[model samples]
Structure formats: structure tokens, C-alpha cells
Target: MTTTASYEQLKLLKQFIDESKTIIFYGGAGTSTESGIPDYRSKHGVWTAMTRDGFDPVKYANPQFIKKYPEKFFAKNEERDNRPVPEPNATHKILANWEQSGKDVRIITQNVDGLHQKAGHRYVLELHGHHRLWHCMSCQREYLSEEVKRDEDNIPRCFVCEGIVRPNVVYFGENASKDTVGKARRSMKAADLLIIAGTSLTTPLAKRLIYDFEGDKIVVINLNEVNISPLKADLFIQDWVGEVMTTLSEMN
Candidate 1:
């Protein structure tokens, strides 16, 4: 159901890319959709389905929930467990290629999927924690993706202290650390061009960060026009991110 960018838009995007120096990419779930990851706010997103079933997905993702009800917090949902592992697509690859080519390019992502890193981007600031990280609530010991074990209840436990293990991601009730937010803000402040892709601007923090950028060009590429309406971006392209980025990369 998605489409590619038009010729005019592609030409315009390429012009912006060629002119800018310090470029920063602000991305969300949509950035990963080309690799088979679903956006969390979409009609078929994880949060959407949970909300339809009368469950507040954010509450379940909260750190407070884990503190209050460790059992329920650690309870495994088959849906989350069975989520398809996605690879980085053209957008991620193109951005990484830009960074590798000595451009002052940085990535600020709201996704925890780690696809950007997998795509070989070195300067990625993950606003949300990664899914692969597991840490002990008590000792604060970190566990790799393979080290953690699940119990009969599917609750992950720490190997050393037998304490509850939690994902490193930021939940709805919890705000990102000041350091993390500061890093993202710094990148925005330095950017000559800001490319926002695949996000609906639903998160207040994301909106604040985007508006805070005093950049030369603010470009938004997405699959829908509705998400970018309030943005007032210098350039708005309603198309698949990977397609647009691929075309831009080729032109560059």
C-alpha cells in the first residue's frame, strides 16, 4: 500500500542533502517499517491492538508497573515474544553510508529495535532503551541478550542476585534521562539539516526536539500527510522513507 517519491520531490531532497553539512536524522517506528517492523501507533500496531483490547500498553511498559507488580510486569506476551526481528532497510543504510563518508551526520531514534546500529551508524542516540538489554533491578548488573533466563511464568530474572530483570527501554510513565535528552538536543542544535522520517510526531518529546532545531532545512518524509501537517517542515514528502532515501543517496 506504500508508494515511492515523485521525481520533483526526489530532486528537491537531493538538493537539500547536497547543500547541508551537519545533518541529523530524527526517526521513529516508521523508519523501521520497510524492514518489516510495524509502527506502534498504527492501526495494527502493538499499542493499538492492546488499546483495542482495553489494556493500556504504556502502563504495562512503565517501570513503576515492574516495581509494583513484578509478576505481571515480567509476564511474557506471545505477541511481543514472536515479534519479527527486522533488519535495516535502505533508509538506515543510506544514513549510515552518509556518516561513514565523513559527513557530520547523527541519528536520534525513538525506536529500540537497534536497526540503525545494525546498519553501521556509529553516532546513534537511542531516546528509548534497546530491547536486547536486560538489567538486574537490585544489583544493576547488565545482561546480554543471551545470558538472561526465563522462568515458568516467563519472567526474566537476574543470574547473580536472582532479582527481577527489566528492559532498558523508557516506558510511558518514565521520562528519558536528562543526559539522553541533552545529547539529542545538542545534535539538533548542531544540525544544518534535519530529516525527520517515519514518525507521526505523537511523542511530546519528539515534537519538542524537532521544534528546538534551528536548522537550515527541515525535511519530513513519511507514508501519510496527516502526521506532517502540524510540522510546517521546509519540505514534506509523503512516501516510503526507504524509497526516498534510496533515491536521494543515488543522486548524492
Candidate 2:
């Protein structure tokens, strides 16, 4: 399903990669869609499904919701933990190869899936935190996701402080990790080319980070149009991230 226009855009992206010494791959939920993960804003995504069920996904996924309805929150977490783990797709492999091949590449992702690291990417900044990691709310002790399974009452408790244990993800209405954000900002400022992929830039923090890039060029590849004002993409490809990345790899 690769169109001629998409090939042309791939050529441009290749040229950008060739010219730039430092590159940043800023990714979102759509980056994992090819790996059987659903995006948040897409029509059939998590948000849409929540809305269809008469629930506000943002409210339901918030940290406050965890306190107000511990059982419900933990139940949702249990369900998510029970789902099959998704594997890294072409996009992740391509980016990881770029980094391994000595292309000064860094990844700044808004996804909690940890697919980038799963694909052997070393320089990844998880802006949204990771789901595979868990932490105690009171003791701040960390644990792997598997170590903190919910009990029969649908509550995962920290063994040390007997406190609530939650995934190490930045929920809606929660501030992102300042350390991660600062590191990402530094990478953006140092990058010569920034590739915005798989995201509509709907999240305010993600949008703000995009604006922080004082890079030489910006390349956007997504299945939808990106309408961020005052910031025009040097190359925009309205296509699948995996397809675009796969083609780009082939070009090289």
C-alpha cells in the first residue's frame, strides 16, 4: 500500500537523515499501532471505546480515580496486564538500527509500552513513563510490573509499606517526570533533524515539546493531518509509521 507520493516523501526523509548529524525521533501511541496496540485518539482507539461506554477516558485514567475508586482502577490495570504483550514492529527496529549504526539518534516517546527498549534502543526517553514498571505510592519502592499483581480484591499493595502500588506511568492530570522532560528537551535542542511520528500532537506536553525543537528540519509521518500552527513540517507523510520507516530503511 505504499503510494508513489509516500516513496517521494521517504526519499526526502532519507536525505534529511543523511544531512543531519543528530536526529530525534519523537513518537506517540500510533508508533505501536502496527504492533497491535491501539492509539488513544483514533476512532477505534481507547478513548473512543471509553466514550462509547459512557465513560471519560481521561477521568477514568487519572491518579485521582485511583484513590476515589481503587477497586475499579486496579480492575482496569488487571485487565491491561492480562492482555498479550505486543512486540516491536518495523519502525522500532529501524530506529534502533539507526542508533546502533552510529547515527546519533535519540528517541523521545509518549508511549508507556516500552517497545523502543524492547527493540534494543539504548537512548530512549520515556516522557509518559513506562507501564512495565511499578512503584509504591508511599514508600516509593520500585518493582517490575509482574511483581505487583493485584490481589483477589483487585488491589496491588506494596509489601514494604503496605501502600498502594501503581504503574510507573504518568496518568492524565499528573505532571510528567521532570528529569525525563529536561533530558528530552536537551536532546531536542541538540538535534539537527526532528522526526515527529505517529502522533497527532494532541497532548499539551507533547505539543509543547515539539515547539521546543530549534532543529534545522522537521519531518512528520502520521496517518492523519497535523495542524500545529507556526510550525510547518519540512516533510509530511500521511502514512503508516511502520510502512514509512520500512521504506526508508530499504532506501538506505
Query: Per-residue CA lDDT of candidate 1, range 65-142, in tens?
Result: 787777766653445557676788988898898889998889999998899899999999999878788788889999
* RMSD to true structure for each model, in Å: 2.2, 1.4
- Give the backbone clash total of model 1: 0
- For residue 231, give model 1's deviation from the true position in Å: 6.5
Candidate 1's displacement at residue 51, Å, is 1.5
lDDT of 1 at 7: 81
Error of 2 at 18 (Å): 0.8
Judge candidate 2 at residue 41 and give its lDDT. 81
- lDDT at 188, model 1: 92
Tens-place lDDT per residue, model 2, 78-169, is 66667798899999998999899999999999998999999999999999899788898888999988798566787988888877899899
Deviation in Å, model 1, residue 27 alpha carbon: 0.3
How do the predictions measure up, each by TM-score?
0.91, 0.95
